[model samples]
Target: MIYLNQAGYAPNSTKRATITGNNHYNLFSADGKKILSGECTLEFDENSGENAAVIDFSEVTEEGRYFFADEDNFRSPEFVISKNHYDQALRDSMKMFYFQRCGMELEEKYAGVYKRKACHCGGGYILGDRFQRRKMLGGWHDAGDYGRYVTAGAVALAHLLYGYEMFPGALTLNLNIPESGGSLPDILAECKYELDWILDMQDEDGGVHHKCTSASFCGFIMPDEDDLDMVITPVSSLATADFVAIMALASRIYHKFDEPYSNTLAAAARKSWTWLIKNPSFIFENPKEVTTGTYEDLCDADERFWAAAEMYRLDKNEDAMKVILGTMELHLSMHCLGWADVAGLGTLSIINSGTDFFGKDLYNRLVMKWLDEADRLKLISQSNAFGITLRPIEFTWGSNMVILMNAMILCVAHKLTGDDSYLKSAQYQLDYIFGRNAMDLSYVTGIGERAFKHPHLRPTAADNIDAPIPGFVSGGPNFRPCDEAANPDNMSDVPAMKRYADDVRSYSTNEITIYWNSPLVFVLGYMNSL
Candidate 1:
């Protein structure tokens, strides 16, 4: 979405100026220029009588100027072209949280990499522990600490537009600003405490110890005397998928920005990806072995697909291609058990595989499955006896799986294979999502249903938070990713969601969600080919 240069992150290509009219303001660039409105069909002329604004790139003579989004002048008309493109990049990020929902001015916080779920102009940036903030990505760093791993991904993204900046010790990376304004670790160059701790929890083989964390980082010092008040944890499930999800995210950013991939970081992700692909289980008994468990216990669908998809982006290997195609088929076909029943969410991941596996029969098969499946399921509704879905359980609760991922998948499928049916499916979701946006006509509320809400910051400590956790433990590579893991049924118990709007609400923050954004980038990316 952002015009990252050939060299990764900020390149000489973006130095030139460009223009972005307020044509699609309400729909695309909502809030920031909310008053500016125009139809797509509006003809452009000197006196079009519409919002006629232009981003003049006339000052640029070189490539670097074109790719760079000068922060000091970020809101300048001179950098309009690059800004509009960069703003489009926010579509994916917006899914996670509507960055500009109500605020007229864009917050500098959302300008960089964000790790929170809902950062509308009103709320600023709020960190959400993945499970508590599952509507958001529900990944490892969802806990909202604004730590190092998050910083790495943020830095990589910022590099594409704003290279490492003036902030020292920002929460996210050098490129990204943190909630607390601290610099995060470069997960690519080196594995941070979070990854290492999670890694230590796993066996040398690929089986991930459900909630047990691996302390791969330095010397193990016990917590300070002050930590006695903390609730210790153990046996928490560390999702292999979560690890891969972050890797995939960073991978996409790095690839876009043209940053050199670090060996340790890359190898760690490669190992996780290879193991997950080979074993393909959600439960990580050992990092090497992801054996089957309760269907709901597997890592999030988004993480798995990203693992495969990013690998394809990086290597373009048939093996990785096979893995993505096969995984999507498995979930779509027979895996429609508990949470897996809701068919639409996985569409993005599945269709992403289709796009990557372009020209291949397998890609077509996956797309066909989406069309056929949509027909079989009908529509996503909990009140309806036969809601358009393979499994009712997944459809019952308001897990984001039904809203964000479903629309994303449909659109992606349509984009990958130019079948009108795929477009229809995407429209089906857009119809519902956009309808809600029109109804509220204000901010971007979640689409479809309301997912369960857990505590953003739990009462338990790093050690105590783990399921079947041990007691009285403190300190050492203090972060834990197990909380990001959730069961399929977690969707069903959201009592509070019952009070929210229907299955289709405003487009769930299609602003910050990696799952939603990656597919958007891929789909628009492919469509742009035309």
Candidate 2:
């Protein structure tokens, strides 16, 4: 199996393909003519422990479709070299959010073969607040499960918005959502679909519910078949803080197009921030009755910092700035820019907000801090056999998101410093997802020829389609195998990078989520713009 970018490579760029096994390979143009100057090398892979054959086409700069063939395999997938490489991919990745919408019918025209009946229309409860049992309806389904989580949704939205905010007109494409070619950009329109539900999750007092979920995980059935009671879980600091950040961010974007709606978002954000101030220490724990996904975060200083950063950006609140700066000393110790730990979010908000609250020198330092981290990750990625940004420890659940987040940070670094290397590294990470790394499979469904067909998606399972829903990105290559369903694959004893199984039961590697797709959208849109 050979892995090359599905959308192809750019001319005069370093173009390479990975194949497993010890053998020489020859690059061939679409016309079956030898294309490369030198022989390929088969080296031991540190990431997968496989005899990784690397076919380098960096020196072959002609812009044309080509493939590799040798004794170890037949013909590899065809790839091209052109400037507009990721154009179609960018559109497909953005359209994926349309498939993840909850409480809505996926019409045949928009969803194509992935269309489904309306589901999860049942409203949610407020759990234990004064407005306990109050109605909250309509949000994105978290992962393959029929649940709506605030923390995950907030992180996803913030990244998507950041992508839009950072590169103007990047997400300007019409995604063919219900609001395509509307007054608002299609990205914000799709975001509004989720925001409406998020607003419903917020209480009158400004606190946001942690999640709206069923009593238990839904069976391997369609959304319409899942009849469990939908209930809103208790409010938590993580959820409210995330809410504050997303709402404030959304308010800023919507203000330009829809002033009235922007005011509503701003008011909700302010209200949530007030509630967070009073209950800053509140931690959310799932009730014993609820057996759904718990997006629990124990330490919420980062979450608070994220919310404060956004709040300060929106209103220039001195208190918010003080809180953000007070947390700055602890920010350097932060890890990945993942949904779980949003320390990077606060830092990014400060860097992009254009507020001199932290002073110019400090702001410049924060920018350097992020770029330095990207530089370190880039070095690590470049050394790996697969050339992925993920370290050994990052191969946990939702590892694909981790990789995409790395690309997001690298893109930010590129924007800050105008460094071509950072942008190129970012594009390389995106290439890995589109099928240019270990496993030789595109983590995104229905995109590349070798993409995953059996994602752990409810609609895909029930729709009985031969192919999974297009554009849904799987949680690729989980090194730490946790699911009993995935144990039969014998991946637990395998090397970290080689532990992935494409089985539908392998939720660790096969599950799809909005958060994962969100970062993909951000990176793809940014790359597409370039």
Candidate 3:
């Protein structure tokens, strides 16, 4: 079996594949013509305990459909080599957000056969004060379940906003949503849908609610069919800080299109910032009897750091600067871009500010640290058999997010240093996502030749559609499977990378989330830009 990117590659990009045995291989066009031939080199992969034969066909730069054939008549999946190879995938990934919108009816015209009525549009009762209901609607569903979370939404929005900031030309595609043809790009318009909901999550006291969810996850049903009572949970520093960071960033991004709306976001961000200063450490816990997705974090320092950095960027606030320097002194986790550890987003904001708001020395220090982390990920990709940057221990839940997050870092590093090596490593990470892994499965729905169809998304499961909504990325391989479908009983001897089940029941390994697809959008946008 040969593993390569089933989604194809850029014409001038690095193209490689991994097979099990060493042999002379021939690259054949869609016709019977041979394009190139290469000898595969055998090397022992310590992580997978396999003798992998690696093929490098980077020199084949012609635009055409092709496949690799070995001496044993093993033919790899057909892929295309072209400059615009990733354009559709990038558009689909971004459009997935439009499909995930909560309160709006998905008309058949825009959503095709997967249309549904507006869901969760009713005003939600506050968790404690059941009689006092507030109109809490809009924003994409947090994950497979129909919950709406602030921290998750903020990080996901940050990814799209930052991606647009980096590669505006690539992300300016028309998504054909209801908000298409607006002054703002469809990307920002879609993000504004969530931003509007996020703004509602903020309280009069300036603190943002952690989430608005049912007491328990509902059954596998369409969003409108899940009739459980949705309640707004109390605020947390985590949510408030993340809300401030993303809103501040959005204020600047949307200013050119709508200054009044931008001012609203900026004011909300300042209010949240004030709340963060007063309440230094309010970690949210799932209230008793409310058992929905608890995005609980032990520390809110990174969240605060991201908030301060973004606030400082919006307006050179001296207090925000103090928090920034102070957080840097604490040496928080700066390499991770996950919702739980968002110091990297703060670092990114500071680095992208382009003005030495933190002083030239501190700015340079942050750049070097970011590049150093990217270098580490590049080396890991180089050493791995599949050219992915995953270690055995890193195959936790939502591992694909790790892969794409690393790719985002590498792409940014390439942008900063203009080094093709970083970009090449980033391509390898994307290749792993497409179909260059042990399972030979594309973790995204409706992508690649053998894409995983059954995601743990409630809408896909209950919509009665044969195929899931395309472009929803599955939470890839979790060695310590937590769902019944992928539990230890059935996956006792499976390798870490192969410990995935494409079943609706395998929520641990198969659930899809907005945040998961956000970095994918960022990475694909970068690739398309190149």
Best by lDDT: 3
Candidate 2 residue-wise lDDT, 293-395, digit = tens: 8877778888988899899888988879877777877744443466679978878878886647657975887787888898987897677556788776668
Residue-by-residue lDDT tens digits, candidate 1, 349-446:
33444444454565566567666654443343221211112232232223322443344444444544565554444433322222211121111222
Best by TM-score: 3
RMSD of 2: 2.1
The 10-residue segment with the lowest total lDDT in model 3: 45-54
What lDDT score is found at residue 530 in candidate 1?
27
**Model 2: ten consecutive residues of lowest lDDT:** 126-135
Output the better candidate (1/3) by TM-score: 3
Candidate 3: clashing pairs of residues: none
For candidate 2, report its TM-score: 0.95
TM-scores for every candidate against the unseen true structure: 0.40, 0.95, 0.98
* Higher-scoring candidate on lDDT, 2 or 3: 3
Better of 1 and 2 by TM-score: 2
Reference-based lDDT, residue 398, model 1:
30
In angstroms, give how far residue 465 of model 1 lies from its true place.
30
